[model samples]
Target: MPINSYDYYPLSWYPDSTRIKRPKYEAIITLLEEDIVSGVLKANTKLPSQRELADYLDINFTTVTRAYKLGVEKGLLYTNIGSGTFVSSNAFKSITISTDNSPAASIDLGLVSSFEQCNALLVPAIQKVAGQQTITQFLNYQAPTGTAFQKEIAIRWLSTLGVQTIPERLSIVSGVQNGLAIVLSALFSYGDRIVVDFYTYSNFIELAKLFHLTLIPISADLEGMSAIELEKICQLQEVKGIFLMPSCNNPTGSILSASRKKELISIIKAYQLIVIEDDIHAFLTAPFLADYSPPIYQSLPEQTVYLYGMTKFICSGLRVAYLVFPERFKNTLNRSMFNINVKTSSLDSEIITEVLHSGLAQQLLETKKALSQEANALFNTIFDCQEVTGHHPWPYFRCLPIPKHYSREYIETYFNQLGVNVYHSDRFVVKSDYEKAFIRVALSSSSSLEVLETGLLKIKEGLVGLE
Candidate 1:
């Protein structure tokens, strides 16, 4: 192996030989990360072959392999099946939804706002809950799965969205994200594969990484995620579950139709995949669309954990949502809920119950819907929208497709520099090979109507010569 040092070829990365630490693998990752963060190695740059790197460094090939594996796990790199390993598309960018780092007057078009204008509508309910004689009941440490009264309210709140579920089968979690954590922790083992749409909620993507779950990215059509692709993936590998936002998918606003649901259900049944239905936005869309497909949970109740989030519609600060699961998984879900969340605040649950009971929740939904309409209309005036699902009730975010020339990295930083904080499509991507790109602009995030309008217009001006 030491036959010829003269035959060595140049590497994409030239690490300083003297700088590598004793344990070469960790040092390799450190230097690789340093190079990536410093911008010396750009996104999607293919790295040297593992064997070639090992030979160049005069170390065992397994060390380089371990280093490359660690790099992928760290989100600093990704590998295409046949193609060699390369830097992750999101390696150079920091994914976040906060404006803490943005300069003053920065219009936030990143975080999906719940249209905070509707929060004022909940004041009466909060006051009513505070005045009740039984207010101290919520302070008790009992009812980890919510009190009977709270579950009754959950049933009533769910009924509005056409969901039929009894108190025994339902659990009140803090939010959809919380329910998701319980499901993943209680059900799935590490390294389990789950299928997802090409582009999805960025938070979910990070959550999967945290749990070490492999996400098999599937292609999407006019109707959400494709069934044909699901079949192909199932045939190739074992997928434990699937995550879907069938009713108004986040970031893209794609909705799955009835016929398409049947197609996917067949695949789910054949594969026996646990369906994690995030119907968080159904309340906003179902009332408007007469022909909206019913939640998949209804068809496969035995194999689904349906989450209905009230954050975007009622009150985001309350951090309240509901989850309905089958009786078979009750023990595991309950145990995980107890371990992860000692209890989802009964105080927050009570206020939400009062809101639902007093009919303020309906008023809040209507007001939020009206605000959503105004925001969508404002977005339409500035940019052209290609309708994804039929009779689409504009979701909180809009996808603005861009030319290939507008790299995802540039779109993010450039937008922030122009006083707008938006996210590139790559932020929501799982493992897509699609060439098209876009940025997801949160229409409902701004403080007032005028602020949203100003942000959208700023984006239009920024695309002057790029488009």
Candidate 2:
């Protein structure tokens, strides 16, 4: 069925060119939502004329107009008569749709962050700090690398993860993302090549773009990045650094094997490349962590800047992280972090230091690991998804194979109607040619076991293409 075409300006924003099962309007809605949330469409960025978008997509003009109208209603877009339509300034804020016609409400399975299991300890930890007689110490400005007391706690936490470090080499940042930014800005220049897995964390991809760094994606398999391929790339390019999440990596949950870690580190030494090892999920994967691999920092301690994050397992609100920098780069890292952040969060640093010194942090982590196991078990009961269970901590993401004849967008929309939201594999790809018929089901964000069960059942039904 073809609608009459209308002549209009050429629109550059186009959805994936492949054939799709979702209606044009729904597809456009999803595209706008994703682009706005991902910062691809900047705030107040003007959108092409509705007819122009329709013509570009070969969709009916009325369908494009309807999509724009829905976008506006959903707080994702706004139109100015003289200037045309544009992404809303507040497009990144929570989107509230009228609940009358749509299915009850959607549960978020896209965000991987989880701290609900640790709130029992977290709330009291906050209160305990609030009541401290020396509480005023948290109100004053402190070093950008945090106070000596806080650095000591950071070092103690790293020791548990098998990365032995001292207070002298530790620099505290707001979170793991901030630590990554500091390392990249302080150590490497723009256009320097940094290697990562082909399908890596979305945040790292965006960070690479923001910092103007050249990302060389190495092909990876079930066990994680291919050391053989990485060696090939190193010989061909002047690689500066390698970024990895060795323990319970995100999205795929692929852990780098012990032998492979040693192999990769040998190559790193040969190439004289820096290693930015992200170990935020190390604590979560504690049960199985010891059996699989040691931290890369252990092998390449002189070249690795180990990012140990406390936000995931302990409390996201605290926003505290510890970076174990190479002793040689200490002066440069400290100066760069100081310029970027001015100072660390005094309150957050003090609270995390107290949390670690007390036995609460360990207990909270144990409880979280157990809860994650339970959640993974519950998920496994309903869907024939990936094997993301075991001792690994963040059971938030489960990669499911797409059913025959279903696009990621089609499956995502089917679940959307059932009040469950998920992210497709396309969002995490580092290479342009990367394609996969799969979706990432995040198990951590549902409010309760009951909600998770409901969402999982719906997801299961959709996976089989059942109505």
Indicate which candidate wins on TM-score: 1
- How many residue pairs clash in each candidate at the backbone level? 0, 2
C-alpha lDDT of residue 174 in model 2: 87
Please report, in order, the local distance difference test score of every candidate based on alpha carbons. Answer: 0.82, 0.73
* RMSD of every prediction: 4.8, 11.3
lDDT of 2 by residue, 253-346 (tens): 7777777788888899999999999988887665445475668888788998999887777776677888897899999998888888887798
Q: Say what the RMSD of model 2 is.
A: 11.3
Give candidate 1 regions above 4 Å deviation. Answer: 1-76, 79-83, 89-96, 384-391, 432-434
